[model samples]
Target: MLNRYNPHAMHQGYYRYPTISGDTVAFVCEDDLWTVPVEGGIARRLTTSLSMVITPRYSPDGQWLAFVARDEGHPEVYVMPAEGGEPRRLTYQGAERVEVVGWTPDGDEVIYNSTAGRPPREVVLWRVSLEGGLPTQYPYGLANHISFGPNGAILLGRHTGDPARWKRYRGGTAGVFWIDRTGSGEFTRFQPTDGDLTAPMWIGERIYFVSDHEGIANIYSCLPDGADLQRHTHHEEYYVRYPSTDGKRIVYHAGADLYVLDLATGENRLIPVELRSPRTQAQRKFVETDKYLQEYTLHPQGHSLLLTVRGKPFTMGNWEGAVLQYGEPQGVRYRLSRFLNDGTRIITVSDASGEPCLELHTPDGVTRFEAFDIGHPYRLEVCPTADRIALSNHRFELHLFDIEQRTLQLVERSEYGMIEGFAWSPCGRWLAYSFAPNERTHIIKIYDTETGAIHPITQPEFRDVLPAWDPDGEMLYFISLRDYDPVPDNLQFEMAFPMGMRVMAVVLRKDIPNPLLPPPRPFEETK
Candidate 1:
């Protein structure tokens, strides 16, 4: 969450897609193109379009700027004066993504990659002349990151860089950097190691790129033949992202701050580009909150609804009355609330103190308690008796919290998986839940609160889940995938269960008879 909005609050703007042209550093922030001096100071917004501007690149002569912006649903290439002016749309590819790679070395055309005229996943490079007209594709079919060098030499990266999705990613899809020294349509793979290699920039004689080979992503440089391998910009926390060069300096962003790395002196510095515009989006505005409403339930007596919205947990009156939102700490998220047996008290989970805690909201005030200071309570249900509550966190543990005692009891720590689909018996003494023994099977388990004993009533061979108890507490009902009627796949050599689910029941006591067993006579004979 952002802090309270102050129009004059001059904090450094969090920007991305940083490109350098001489002493000017151009980047996109707040959905607008912004420029500031390389020495770092107050920034100025370049375009008033206020669209999704990204990947801004400066022309070789530093006279024109090319970028991608989306005014409608689709993104297209656009160009404008290097300083600031009205942007001119360059590409008319309707529903494809256009990412600005850079301008040509001669500054006559802009180079970009798009999914147009190809498969949705296959991206190829294209060039549009500055004088307008149709765009033409490069000779290569599929490539992502490309940087041109002097005398027709080029560096190609197989994939673009993204820190959020591909940080420390070591898989088959991980891109490899390649170089073409002759520009004769022959490209060979360089730096064949297994790391997320991307954002290749062929600066002068050495090729600079971002890689996580040292377990942390940083800017690294190596000879065109994949030697030397000098590591620059040792960022241990945030990965260096989208490093673009303007012949002398490399501009990229790590986390939210823009940084510049000089090629000759090896100097790295943060560009503190501050903003002065009113951040209306960051200001707290009133919302209907129905859009963010989640996990709602009726009141104990069907008078109102207890629900959690984007901000906090609140109650809405069914007939007439003002909506009551419980007083909570700002930025604390609450969920899964229910009216206690008292019909006036509410119990839910809150991350107020930075961890999950049981919060009780009553007519007087609010009180909170934690369960031995562990586990995040995402699933919660009030016992019909209302003295106890059942909690299940992401740690695969089930707990019982006593409202009066303010104590937590570790009822069961599931050894295999989560203890979902739990139900409190009408008597509130036996809690029935579906517990998994392995990844493939779930068995109904009953826990006796008074006796502290557990009993598994179902077999492991059958996959069962979602346990519900009868009102009289004599039987427990569940759904089981016991019937495996397999059907062979039409496309491949595999089988799938078309209809396997069946309603299952178990008699809780030895004196009760199995309802599923037959009477000893056929239906017609009995009739």
Candidate 2:
């Protein structure tokens, strides 16, 4: 049985899209609808459907709850009693992507936004009747989050970019605007700023919204005419998102806790919400190792396969041997493990030292070394002679590290794009990598460590990648997209593939004979 829940003691799970009525707040927790008191108390589950439900909005009268649910494979608008009961489907033509905006002033219809017959960057607002009927689209062109104002005026917050993907963005599409629904279809910039603004809530004569103008996102308020701007919350750590108002108080999520700001007193307090549902996912359970496998690589000598599963490095025999696990400390992540030249040590990028650093695991012990000063190391390749290591970091800058000398060299800074698929020559004298010169194609380049000179191996017109050094160091092998063999498609009246890929070998020296050419017959000295 589940234990008695206490709101002040519980602090787990993600809560989103909160809408407050008189004193009760409806929100989504772990893809399920739930309700909790505004003064902080235990939450009661409202819906138990297996499908995901989100974006719950309360009716103006506070008797009905409207939300978007994917119970029937596609997201549709559903309305149920605010106190919890059977939900009635209102929109049959709901698309896979839909959001519950708010209810009409009369509470007879629930307004929502859908991507049906519209581009991904734009969504049209549609209002569906609570009695179940077709939804009517608003005359708006491109609006994501909207709030109704006096005289049929709409405070439109155009798509301000995805909050989950980008942060602190001040691009072109970053601020909110206003549009008049009953008049000409024209949008005017409201509260113009370089920061990203979203979640506009029109309460009385003031408009409340969240913006990252002062670094971190915080609650700010301005008049309907876009004057007398004031910042309500002074949050500088995490962004305040998904704010809702009941005309008296503003409730928003900051980090993992929900906070409510009293408009009159400007007092912000945490709304401790305790979940009484079963902790099925938090409970300890054995997980199958096979399904959690992330990466695998063959050993240099083909003796065993190195695998990284759930951020733990392990080695399993290719034919026969007991599995060996090289587990690190808690909260540390290890990636891209490769065998060293001695075959007794493994080099990998690990965050064991609180930051991403190069680590060498040997039979004796593990050794840590800082690889970069700015960005974390991503992919690395150990030289054949074990003298140098070529690696690229999160900043897309390639670097060469000398192990014995404990020195680092800036190989090259890729201005156009990321440098990828790099390999060290057999003699460890040069490094070959690929980078895109323009937006259309990639070219191969070689960097000589001894001379500190760089040279281009392939032209920028063709794309080349996956470079490998021929064991003798006389030729370099790479894959290029030069084959233009097109295959006609039967289903569509067009060519399926206009170009393919083929492996090409380049002789480093001009005196070296072409490997693809037939070998000349052995002749006597007379010739």
Best by lDDT: 1
lDDT of 2 at 405: 84
- TM-score per prediction, in order, is 0.81, 0.88
Per-residue C-alpha lDDT of model 1 across residues 169-258, encoded as one tens digit per residue: 877767677778877768888883457888888888888888887877788888787878888787778888877998899999887888
lDDT of 2 by residue, 1-527 (tens): 11222444685667777889988988888788988998877889999876889888999899999998888878999999999899988888747579888888898999988887765556778888899877899876677777877777777878743453468776676656675544355667776445788888888788888888788888888887777898888876778878878779888777766778888887887778987778666687898879988878777688888898878888889889799888474578888887777666787878777877777788988877875562677678888876578888777788987767877788887666677689999888889988777766778889988899999999998778878999888888899987777899877789876558888888999899887889887677564
Error in Å for residue 162 of model 2: 4.6
* Model 2 TM-score, all chains together: 0.88
**Pairs of residues at least 3 apart in sequence or in different chains that clash in candidate 1:** none
Q: What is the lDDT of residue 525 in candidate 1?
A: 62
Question: Backbone clashes in each candidate structure, one number apiece?
Answer: 0, 0
The candidate 2 region of ten consecutive residues with least summed lDDT is 1-10
